[model samples]
Target: HGEDDHGVHDGDGPIASDPSWCDVFAAAAKNVIAEVFAHAKTPVETRRQLQKNKMRREAARQTRRTKVVRQTTVTATRDVQLQNHDDHRVTKTVSGGASPFVSAASAMQ
Candidate 1:
């Protein structure tokens, strides 16, 4: 009656005590481990690819930023040069051109 209630018990012994059950369990565990490793490997490779893409995008963005900065710097330099040129022309006209006001003041003196 003790063995009859336990349905897993074969004529020889319990199914848990079978050597074939141990082999089946071991094979199932190995398969699970292999699947885990396979899943792990895919993510690592995907991460590496993602990282490389990120780096490439960053590099491209940096290049574009540098180009913009260079263009702005060139424009600013040109504007400064034009301002200096205009200032120089104004100084020359004030110093070298004869003014009627200056002549009249000198005559009064």
Candidate 2:
């Protein structure tokens, strides 16, 4: 690729535009791609945050549900114990035992 007498290579006509057009076009393309990617990144970040919040809320609800279940179990156990204690007192009263209700009451206290 030898240059002609007019410094134009390959017998082509004189150049009309800037010689750095390729570099300028490449820089402009890179800028445009970066801007598009930046704009597209917002929704991804927002969706990630939303998913995290949703998981937190679900975990909170599950914890509350588990706590309620545990409390219910404790209450049921207490109720069964009280009913058995009452049954024992009635049996002792009818059978002439030395009144086990007093001991049960004292234990409860």
Each model's lDDT comes to: 0.80, 0.79
lDDT of 2 by residue, 40-95 (tens): 77787876886799999999999999999999999999999999998787767757
Stretches off by above 4 angstroms in model 1 are 1-42, 98-109
Across 1-109, the per-residue lDDT of candidate 1 in tens digits comes to: 5746656533567766889998999999999999878757787778788779999999999999999999999999999999999767655665887467555544666
User: Runs in model 2 with CA error above 4 Å?
Assistant: 1-42, 97-109
Lowest summed lDDT across 10 adjacent residues in model 1 is found at: 3-12
> Cα-based RMSD of the predictions, in order?
24.8, 24.2
Model 2 residue 79 CA deviation in Å: 0.5
